[model samples]
Target: MDVVLASSPVDGDVGCWDLQTGAEQMRYRSCASAPHGLASVAGRFLASSQVGNSSSGSILYWSWHKPQVEIKSFPVEPIVSLVSDPDGSFLLGGGSSGNIYIWEIGSGKLLRKWQGHYLAVSCLLFLDNSLIASGSDDGCVRVWNLVSIFGERDNERMKDPFLFSFQEHALRITDIVSGFGSSNSILISSSEDRTCKVWSLSKGKQIRLITFPCIINAIALDPGEDVFYAGGRDGKIYLAALNATCPSNGKFDEYIITCLNEHSKAVTCLEITKDGLSLVSGSDDGTVRVWDIKSQRVIRVLKLRDGPVSNILLVQLPNSTSNLERVAKLPSLDKNLDPTGTLTAIRISPLNGPPDFGYCSSRLMLNAIKELKQRSSVGAMEMELDRLREEQRVCAQLLQRRKKLFDDLWRARIDTLLDDDQ
Candidate 1:
């Protein structure tokens, strides 16, 4: 497995963790306080946002072999969000001044800088090398086309690289994540307004706006893009369907498929593994939980520091054949068994893990629903069987009519032959 890296700016520590043994190789420092500012550079090095207050912010790059920062670049403004390009050629930072700074990684040279929004930029991501998406405190999401901006030879030919803006959330943007459906496909943003909005880049409009009962702190999309997990401040993770119908008025109960309450404190951050099979979540309780997405259960939990769990990263170590073997050993959808054995209910998995044991677990609800539920299941099955028999009878009658028609056609052909002979 890749050494999962987690950071706590308050504790001034960056730790390398593995699931097999909970022993942590944490490297603590005094000058590091960047929240949600750590990103891996293609397994080569780690990049993080240094504590930036206003117009004075810095980004540091540390080699994988060393504990000290190998390179540093100080931008004019304080940086709140940091990301590296796919190829690790350049780095991008969203600043407090609502400006984006791009620098070459090899030689800390400023490549391109642009004023992105009207307020502080909260989150930033590269949709691709040519296009990047940014979210701001002004409650606007903007897309910039690097090709159009850097491609221009003259200022007259240079149109504004701003491609599209999605403005729907009524509060400060807390987190923005891309790479869901396709390249520049779907962008989901979380906010303090207790809503997560989905924007379709190809459609150039907002497709869905999901409202919750509490402020959604973090979000992660499933690999299939059919559903997403929203981690909330209420200490619950709600699973919502994307294709499922929501009320036209946007106030009714949207299709929340399920909720996972594995954490006791507020969920602060979330990240899905590369294969999207597992979800890593950090909480205010200072624990990093690994969740089995399919089984909707917690596989492992690592308590790192005493302070709040601020950020988490799941990486793939170089010798990761064991991870692949574990993935292959995972039981199929129908098997209700969580291979991790965290949810150890002794029962037959009737295709969907343990039979809604919740149905039988609660004394109050079980007493209330037992008789009605008993009658409903058996009655529904008998009704369905009767309907199937009626459908089969209709098929038999249709087949007889077709046979009669075929006999008539043969009789007509015989009469024509007799007339020719005469």
Candidate 2:
């Protein structure tokens, strides 16, 4: 039952296709759909965000094998992005007013609402069950620690409120994806600035910034985390290096090794499969294309009349054990996606210990030494402060005694002057 689901640009007509065969399954009439605003709600249903000229922003859920919306809810503001937890327990919506709204999937109840960005939230995704990665129009990609944001906070000062805020993109952020680098530390972000940047979480900085000939709207990572594909307005998909920290053998850091020439217009959304073998890309041309990653060529194309394909999803359901027989199966990947084409892939590599702050060992040691020295001097400084306070108290007492003595002496002088006058 694995299928590729997509929405049309006009009035939200949803269509499904068999992933393995590229055969069209069924078509559903969408009430409406936003750009990059579709997400598969587990394997049971699909969720999409829609904002039309006459209708308010709403989230609509569609059941499999049906063309009508199953459930729908309206939010206060126009929702631009949507995502749900892996278990389908909660769904999150990014609004135009810079707020993120979470709702319970079963009951459609509002779970919590918090401000996630300034101006507007352009993209969002669940890095895992615990972390939510968001990209904003403010030109930043931020990682929100779900545990800290929703868990206990009894005076723990939130250091760097966001798990991490990537400020590499100077212009409005078009898309951001993780799971490309290790430990969710690595991130890929595209912008209207015509650049796609690769970040290292273990390194905590921009490992490489690949500039494209046109503005990049969407990005997808290679399965091995070695290369990433960027879809730009120029109708070209470029492959950029990920692990190349510096230049290779004196040459410039391999920016774009190759390009996939396909769509004639801007590429809006991109999705790679769990096996990392194939990729699905949607464009403004109202077509969905599946390409073999190794071949770097389009193998099948599902042309649609939906103005343009706003968002795409490759849904892979977990296999259930059979009582009759047990067979070999492929491993599921740690993949990430957004409701919109502005994707944020989150693949958190197994962190052996604590989080890496991307600081050099030597610099960290120096800071540790300085911190120890400061810690050791704290007691001495506290004592010195106490001594200063005691000295000030003693001076105040001495001044009080002198004032009393002067007053008494003045009174005696006045009495002697009065006697002389009599």
Candidate 3:
């Protein structure tokens, strides 16, 4: 897999590195200001934000294959973070001025602007195709229904439709992540207040809040969405299960958490691949470590010669037919299943080799297989449920026709008997 690492130096130049070879591939010095946030779409294009004395920041897009060419550059003001839509059609950027702008990815055209936050928006997450959650520095998180905003406009423009907002922290929200389990729409946000809060999108309320020893630097969810791993400035990583209950409005319960103090420096970035076998973490210690999530141990540590690893991205290696083959071998759904029913079985393949029963095996291939199984089971169940619903509708129509025919025949016999009596 190709890994792209971007870092913004204090000198106002953006440095791009190829993680696989540990080589500095390209450097762009457009804005004379320091960059703060970096975001990428499809691994082909990246957007880096410049934040310094310049009141207006700019986003620089670079070609992933040939990092020398500048694909596009657009100007934005007080930009805090940038995020691309799931399909990469639009790029959403939040600014310190409490304005969010959506731009066409390819053209860099301003599509719409969302204004709702009372303070600077720090983090943004696309909950689904038509919903976005934005957390502000004002300690409030707002959920926006993008469908309602777009549906009301005739010109395909988006207006602000703040579905709900919650003030759970006394400080800025640093990170936000959307989970991928049966409770799909759950969102977790980490703040400078040394706490992580879980919010339910369906209910539009805070469900749980987890406190930490120090400021939480980064947070990541397991592929199963059942567990959460949070890294803190205290150089420790904490693992907590989502099923554990906590103090809602008042009551305290079992919110057990396991802490691992392996890193000597603050963990800056954490990413889990689509196949949940391995997790990679980048830290301020200038090292990137790949961890076996099942064993909760670091397997490989890739040391860097330059500055600290600020970010780490895992891209699927091109021409890797094995990954595709593993995905194709997933099981099909049964004919009888509810479309909305939760998935029961998840087959996890090994990461380095073939499928195995042992946990934390070095086989990447096996881990991929297991991850594929989980995804396929859920998808197949949904498909089967849809098919069954259509069949049920057809059968109901046939039964209704048969009942009508029987009623008509009985009525005809009664009329004939009455006529004979007369």
> Which candidate's lDDT is highest?
2
Please give the lDDT score for candidate 3: 0.60
Q: How far off is residue 148 in model 1, in Å?
A: 1.5
Q: lDDT of each prediction vs. the true structure? A: 0.66, 0.68, 0.60
lDDT per residue, candidate 2, 1-422, as tens digits? 67887886578578788988888877878655766578876554677888787535777766565677665666777888888787665678887877766664433345455676775788887766666778888888887755455442321234455656888788888887888322434678888888887765544457677877788889998778888888888788877777664344432235677778889888888999888999899998888899998888899899775578878888863343221011111111111221222112111122485322121222343455567567787755554564466569756855664564355446546755776799
Q: Which stretches of candidate 3 lie above 4 Å from their native place? A: 2-36, 152-160, 181-184, 245-256, 303-309, 317-422
Better of 2 and 3 by lDDT: 2
lDDT of 1 at 52: 37
Model 2 misplaced regions, further than 4 Å: 152-160, 180-184, 245-253, 317-422
> How far in Å is the alpha carbon of 195 misplaced in model 2?
1.3
Per-residue lDDT of candidate 1, residues 1-422 (tens digit): 55667776563667777754656654634335454678875554577877633446566665444566555656666778888877655667787877776654433445556677778887878876556888888888887766555544442233456767778888888787775433337888888888888886665567788888798888887878888888889899888888886444443346676678988899988888777788888888878888888888888888765467766766554442221222121111111112221211111113453222111112332344555456787755654564466569756855664554355446546655776799
The residue-level lDDT of candidate 1 at 392 comes to 92
Residue 58, model 3: Cα distance from true site in angstroms: 1.1
